[model samples]
Target: MFGDIMGMMGKLKETQQKIEETKKRLDFVLIDEQSSDGLLKVTLTANRTVKSIEIDDSLLDDKEQLEDYLVLVINKAIQKASDVNEAELGAVAKDGMPNIPGMDLFK
Candidate 1:
């Protein structure tokens, strides 16, 4: 019984290490999105943190329209980031929990 407990603890530590490594890899994953009209662009990490934005000069003169475009572009960027995160981290999670039936659905 004691050996079994020790073995499980060792597996738990290995799983924790894998999760941490996946998170670190996710930090380097970036998704870029642009508005349909090419007027705005945004870059974000897989965790949905905005990294940068690029706007066309033509939008500068119209503050209201620019704001709208920025919102649209940012939303697209965030969504893309979410998809990327799900695909990447989801695989890691599935690999870690291989014995759980239908575990892939968790993503």
Candidate 2:
């Protein structure tokens, strides 16, 4: 009983380490998004850190339009980054989890 508990603890620790490593790796995974007309573009890392934004000269003339484009494009980039982050972390966590009697966590 104690042996099983100790093993589970060890597995949990290893899983935590893997999760941290994955997060660090995600910092380099880039996600790019642009407006439908391609006037506004944005880039972000899987860690959801904004990397860059490029706006057309035309957009610069219209403050409201630029703001709307930024909101739309940045949100799309963030959603993509979030998906990647979730998938990577979920896989690591699921793979490292110890199989307990009734816990089908990954299902």
Candidate 3:
């Protein structure tokens, strides 16, 4: 009984370590997004940190249009980053989880 608990605790600690490592790794995982017309582009990490933004000179002429493009493209990039972050962390968590009777946390 206690042995099982101790083993589970150890597994949980290892999982936490792996989660931290995965988060660090995600900083290098880049996600790119752009506008449909190709006037704006964004690059970000899976950790949701923006790395770069490229805008065509034509977009600089219109404030509202540029704002719209930025909002759309950045939002798309954030969503993609979020997906990657979740998947990576989820896989690590799921893989490290200890199987407990009737818990079924991953399901």
Candidate 4:
């Protein structure tokens, strides 16, 4: 019985290490989103860090509209990044804790 417990513990530790490694890789996962008119674009990482913002010169004449579009595009980028991050983390969790009841909730 003790040997079985120790083996399980080892497996748990290994799974935890894998989870950490996966999280590190998530830092490099980028999500890009752009406005419908292609006036604005945003790049964000799965870790919710904004990498870059791009705006077309055509929007320069309309400050108010430009600000609105910027906000819209930024939110869209963040949402996309968040969705990808959740999916990746869910995959990790499913791998680490297989066969548990309600585990599909992670998906």
Candidate 5:
């Protein structure tokens, strides 16, 4: 029993170390999340910090309607970036990743 406990402790320590290492890697990694409409793009870091946003040139033709569409695109991109951030964090502690009630993690 004592040996078994020690073995489990060792495993836990290794897992903690691995998680810390993975977190460090996240600082240098960039994750891009995009809108389906493809009119606007937002770049975000793995930590979910928005780095930049870009608007497509085609949007300039219709200034009035373009503003509404741009808003939609920005919202979509932000949502995508949030999802990506959650997914990346989940990847580190994958074993403990939760399953949403009635929702699928694997697409």
Candidate 6:
């Protein structure tokens, strides 16, 4: 019984170490998400950095349309960033504790 407990403990510790290493690795990756329309683009790094943004040239031809599309694009980018963040966090949470309830894991 004691041996089994020790084995489990060691396993848990190793798993934790792996999780930490994965988090560090995530820092180097950029999880990009965007909309089907070229107006909305988001490039978010795993470290939570916003890298760059691009807007469509045609939208600039119309003032009101440009403003509307700009707002739409920003919102979409933010939503996409949130989704990527949540998914990554969920993966990490499941890797460690898959049984925890109310673990929105991202929230």
Tell me each candidate's TM-score. Answer: 0.80, 0.97, 0.98, 0.81, 0.52, 0.52
State the lDDT of candidate 2 residue by residue for 1-107, as single tens digits: 99999999999999999999999999999999999999999999999999999999999999999999999999999999999999999999999999998999899
**What lDDT score is found at residue 97 in candidate 2?**
99
The pairs that clash in candidate 4 are none
lDDT values of the candidates? Answer: 0.80, 0.97, 0.97, 0.83, 0.64, 0.63
Ranking the candidates on TM-score from highest down gives: 3, 2, 4, 1, 6, 5
Cα lDDT tens digits, model 6, 51-85, are: 77666777567899767765665566566656766
Which ranges in model 3 have alpha carbons more than 4 Å from their true place?
Answer: none
Candidate 1 segments exceeding 4 Å error: 1-5, 98-107
Cα distance off (Å), candidate 4, residue 27: 1.8
Q: Looking at model 4, report the run of 10 residues with the lowest lDDT sum.
A: 98-107
How much is the lDDT of residue 49 in candidate 5?
63
Which pairs clash (backbone N, Cα, C closer than 3 Å) in model 6?
Answer: none
Instruction: For model 2, state the Cα shift of residue 43 in Å.
Output: 0.4
Worst 10 residues of 2 by lDDT: 98-107
Whichever of 2 and 6 has more lDDT, that candidate is 2
lDDT of 4 by residue, 1-105 (tens): 687767767776877888788788988988899999898988988988999989899999999999999989999888888898878877776677634455465
Error of 3 at 88 (Å): 0.5
lDDT of 5 by residue, 1-107 (tens): 68776776776676677677766666566655445777767666555566777778887898986777657655665666567656665666555333435646544
Model 3, range 15-71, lDDT digits (tens) per residue? Answer: 999999999999999999999999999999999999999999999999999999999
